[model samples]
Target: MATDHQQCPVAVIGAGVMGTAIATTVLGSGLPVVLLDVGQAELDRAERTIEIQLRHARMMDALPSGRAPGRLVTTTSSSALAGARAVVEAVVEHEATKVGVLTDVAGIVDADTPLISNTSGIPIDTLADPLPRPQQLIGTHFMNPAYLIDLVEVIRGRRTDEATVTAVTELLAALNRRAVVVRDSPGFVTSRLLHPMLNDAARLVDEDVATAEDVDRLMVGCLGHRTGPLRTADLIGLDNLVDSLAALYERTGEQRYRPCEQLLAKVHDGHLGQKSGRGFYDYREALS
Candidate 1:
């Protein structure tokens, strides 16, 4: 049953940027959150990153001033999620790795506890296959810098139950995000529309048609885009963008959705955008 004030002990697995953002956002929602990552080091880094994000969010008025979310608990043990009512997996974009995480967390959490994926483009149908309770599988696509972005796409898998979708949508609304219910399709709505633009920007830079600066200037100035596609890709992370595009193109056979060579090369060189302090434009340590 969907409740207005469901103060669940939410378990967020993964300590990367998105994972920490999920944990921090849930904590800010006044629900107890258990953050489980790969190991002690990752958890420690996650802790630091979240603290930085919260402070930044405060500066941006995204989070309340003079008050911080007090409902966060950190752990390296998967057992920490044993009694959790919901587990949100905010891990890497590999199917095999994510499946393993879903399987292990499902084993630890309560049977009725909903397992959600914070995936950008992974299809929930494939994820559901590895789980015993297929009806419980759902996707919550949080835009990068989760605490800031107000959009959370609630994607329903083929076998997903209506109740679970309603529950998660309500949960996201409680977190103060605008929840958009998207059907289970390759790239869903946001990525399907946004990725091609980003790829185009990458191609422009790759072909030396325009400098990165000019491209961004042209996009924001002439086109009136909030943030240019190339810059947005940097913020989203090239590797993640690549994975999403690859998944979309592979599943739907759309050539335009194919990831660009420059983008793939940047990912291989470890130029993972702002998070890594470099991408198209160099980030000089987390936006001052």
Candidate 2:
């Protein structure tokens, strides 16, 4: 099981924030990266995001003195990943979408290439069920701001092989991150506990027990958290939070995992947090 660097160029699918962050981190680690998405516009946006991150790193003296941004290649086709040693799928958190992307990636890469998913809560076995080689399909849930997050949740499906886990864990280590290997469970460790708290916060807002601001203030002040649970939900996006909650409910049939009505209402209104410019707080002006 060769690490990402040993394989040279790594293929990172999806050009969203997480995808760009993973690609940038890989490139910063001195491995060539091929970033693939559905359209040229998406690729262009990913490129810009990557460049901005790179420049920021340089300003902070995080990148090697002579490292050029040219280490990254952007494309609209998965075929460009033919030479990649491994592929990481950071697409949307939908089961069908992730299965489709992983199926397509399996077709393009070598049989032994490690296929990783950055799903926050979807069960690994469910995502791997459709792939030809489920043993290679593992979860590498990197927190947001992938480049800066030192902790990565490595999830192993029932069929996931030790070699695949070792390869991914070693690759993360190479990039100066810690890996906490966990079994394939809905929400794994972080999301299982975190989402319930976030949903409870939404419940408080729904019940008018406290305003979103007050609840957040309590978490930051009383709980000693850097960010309030509601603000964190805003950052995670209302739609995403709902999806995670739904996934947990579907898997566990637990009432607590059911998304609060207010969360659902906000998603329906399209106030999807930072990306959509509004959620618990308005970001329209700041987004512009």
Candidate 3:
């Protein structure tokens, strides 16, 4: 028999790509969702993004036919988080901002309801430190395009209990995503491996080794990578890349993780990748 939790909505904060994808994946798995954001316009845009992705999934026969489309609710009010079975925070990467959002969400959801962080590289322990239920908070770093990606890095914080980790792992399995359990670290695993390559790629561009397009092509043709490091950084947002690099460098004091001059210049110019219509490539005409 299905318990009442079968009907309880999962609450997702931050309405960005990661949050919306998280909500979309949960809905595809047949769970209701309450997605919260601070701005009405942002929530409206998130709804449109979700609808487009869901329609595309259905067209491709990727979405389960039995899944309900109208199961998601969007709100600007934090009060909507009440009675949520689990909460995932996917806000922009900033320590102070994330800490504040997590603390706020922790107060609304039930003590036992799992709280998850979708941060790419922020230390899970730092975010969990201030929460009332530190043991209940765990890191579930879902990759970009959350609905399509199956790999989720599950980071166990110093204070995170065994039960929380197991519960989150089971939840990932239910969503059809695989979990790679790892101990809390500066960049966990993926970011540490990926970001340095991206930084080196940017340095190549800075030193005029090759055009961004050519560099991306070499990785695709020679390296057999589906997407090159430069393009991936653009998709991830250059501003976000800077933040991630700074966090990694600060935590480990590693010079390789330092944001390169090219990246810094692009961010300074407000060319924040696809979102800003320009970064390594110009999407101005296409995005408009």
lDDT of 1 by residue, 95-156 (tens): 88999999988776665677898887778998889898888889988987788888888899
Give per-residue CA lDDT, model 3, range 1-288, as digits (tens).
Answer: 222443578889988767888888888777788999999899999888888777766676656567565488999999998788778888999999999999998887777777898888998989988888899888887877677777888999998888778778887777778899999888899999999999999999999999999999999999997888898998888998999999999999989999999999999999988878999999999866
Can you give the TM-score per candidate against the true fold?
0.93, 0.92, 0.94
Query: What is the C-alpha local distance difference test score of each model?
Result: 0.83, 0.85, 0.85
Tell how far residue 54 is off in model 2, in angstroms: 3.2
Model 3 C-alpha RMSD vs. true structure (Å) is 2.2
Candidate 2 lDDT by residue in tens digits, 165-191 = 888888887666789999989999999
Show model 3 residue runs off by greater than 4 Å: 1-4, 59-61
Best by TM-score: 3
- Model 3 gets an lDDT of 0.85
Off by over 4 Å in 1: 1-5, 64-68, 285-288
lDDT over C-alpha atoms for residue 280 of model 2 = 95
